[model samples]
Target: MRFFALWNPFVFVGYDIASKQQIKETVRELYSSKPHLTATIGFSFAGLSAALSGAVWTGAVATLIVLACMMFRVWMEHHFRARSSEDVGEKWVRLFVFGSLLSGFGWGLSGALLLYGTSAETQAITMGIACAILQGAAGRAYMTPGTALINISLVIGQMSIGAFAEGNYIYVPAFLLYFTFLASFIQQMVDNRLRQLNAEQTAERLFREITEKNELLRIANERLATKAYEDPLTGLANRRKFDLALAESLAASNDTGSTISLMMIDVDHFKAFNDTYGHQSGDECLQLIARAIGSSLAGRDSLVARYGGEEFVVIVRGEAPDMAIAIAERICLAVRLTSLDSLPSAPPRQTISIGLVSSRAGTPETREAMLAAADAALYKAKKGGRNRVCVHRGPCPGQQQEQDTVVPFDAAKQA
Candidate 1:
């Protein structure tokens, strides 16, 4: 019962029913195999052998028929092979069916012409060759089972005509029984092939889905990381990331005996500005100042971040005190140049006070000390009438003035 079920002609195994695409793809597979080519070459060789054995006319004619069938098969392959499975139409499939039947007819004629009315040994050889061709047809049944059936039946039926004419009563029932077995075998081959194709397609679909999901997961992680360390309004590094960077820089400066500068920048009179021009304008003003400060330090290797409300910080590595002061001066100038036309009843311009602190080689350093010194310098800058750069290191050598380290804003620019 199990054996019958496995090879049952009416039983279509695998998925509920094959999709149209799968059926078309199976039809396309028909063009992928070239069993007929091998059959053509083998018959040609056998024809030549027969001619050498003194059956000249029979051998020559058989060779011609085999060559013609080979040409038909080649033409069918060339015509349809370039078309994709999606492009395969019903008419194209019917044309292929016709070609298979014609080729089978040619092979049957060639076999009958060569082996009919021969000795018992020759008759047995003919039957053996016919059975081999039938098996080849069965193997390809998965590609186009209906076409295979037509080709197999036509080939055997044509050859059987000669066997019946020769009064070979024994060969008839033997051929019929063999045909039934082959029919069952062809059905089983088709079921197995369909199952295999389904498995491959399912695996491919799963691979694609997994790849897409992984890409989406990677993008989500990137977004989460950005929100964790980025200031939303100003697009600068937030205080959390700023503290981490400042600590790392201070540690490297202490270890390598190098210098690093810290600048604490505060928007001057921001509370008064917010009172005069609503909080909406205040936020816009801060955003503009942030961009101006970023532009001032564009060419320098520094990390500019939002320290807190109305204040920002910058970290510059490997710079001397003078260079650090100059950078602070640039920030003062850049913020003073920010346009205020957008704010209602806005002042002529906006300004920011920057405090510069540099930790040189041999200085006992810590992030806390650096932050405190920078904050003290910023307080002095704001108290010294604002819009200036003040250094925490008191006075320069040979300077007599109390505010020697303070870079006062250019009064000439106010004119």
Candidate 2:
């Protein structure tokens, strides 16, 4: 029976881990419906026994006592069901009154049978059946603790009657005491099991909640990290991330004797375009240009970042000066291919100028020097004409001028 009671494998641990208020509400629901069933069962069995036995007066008295006890039990159960924990003291008092009355009636029935000179066997059988019925009814009324107590009590009463029949009156009290203690022990075991089950369920629920919270937090952290390194408008690496990547690339090149190239690209006539087409359209143009530049150099070690308004930067690792210049030409061509008609009231065409610089193999230089060299080349490209690529070949310390230049791409020739 205990195994069956504890054998629910699918018990929800989450419910046990609920707040105190929630647990109380659930207990109330479970307890509220049980007492009525117990009361009905008690009254039905009492009526049946009264009709079965030939002792009409005893049967009638027993029936009345059971009916009164059932009424009191139902009333007290209902009262407790409706009452808060704070009000349970009075409700328990009522329950104790009903229990005492029932116990006293059992004692009276035993004495009355003894006084009437009834056969001990008949008295034992009748009282045993009555006790069994009452215990079964009690099992239906209370929870595990109360049910254990009631059943053990019934077992003790049955044994005491047998002892009395054997004329071992001295042993009867001891047997009763033994069963009473046994009932308490059983009740304690049941309570312990209940507590264990509740604890396991609560732990399972907490684990699930914690797992879900961690998953949510992980996703939130990822989004935050992405936003931190990414430019919101162009969806490219921001200046901070670009600078870090540049520094790392420079360090690796310095250590491994590899070459790194940098490109500074500025949209030609961007201020004019922004003036012709409002700031919103200017933003659209920048987005279009960013996409073109990003598509042109999709190498694993290449990085594109928006340096600021109307300016972008690209870092190319392990590339020669000619290869870097070629990539810049492709970017220039890609930008020209993209239609700028979408820009509101814009000219028929738009273009960008790129300045490319490669780091020397033996000479180590700061990031600022490399950027300055590229900017000088960019100034040369703008001075000659926009929409062209210029490579920086000047000495790092002085003399800023492009050693070589590529002509601006003609839109008509782009077929």
Per-model C-alpha lDDT, please?
Answer: 0.76, 0.64
Any residue pairs clashing in model 2, and if so which? Answer: 13-201
* lDDT, model 2, position 253: 86
After the best TM-score superposition of candidate 2, give how far the Cα of residue 323 lies from its true spot, in angstroms.
Answer: 1.9
> Which segments of model 1 are wrong by more than 4 Å?
1-102, 173-177, 180-206, 247-260, 271-281, 317-323, 339-341, 344-350, 359-369, 393-415
The local lDDT score (0 to 100) that residue 354 gets in candidate 1 is 84
Superposition TM-score, candidate 1 onto the true structure: 0.70
TM-score of each: 0.70, 0.58
Question: Where in model 2 is the C-alpha error above 4 Å?
Answer: 1-169, 394-415
lDDT of 1 by residue, 173-286 (tens): 877888899878876776677678677778878998999999999999999888899999999999999999999998899888888899999988899988888888889888
**Residue 386 Cα positional deviation in candidate 1, in Å, after optimal superposition:** 2.7
Model 2 C-alpha lDDT per residue in residues 7-32, reported as the tens digit of each score: 23222223434555544553454335
Lowest summed lDDT across 10 adjacent residues in model 1 is found at 6-15
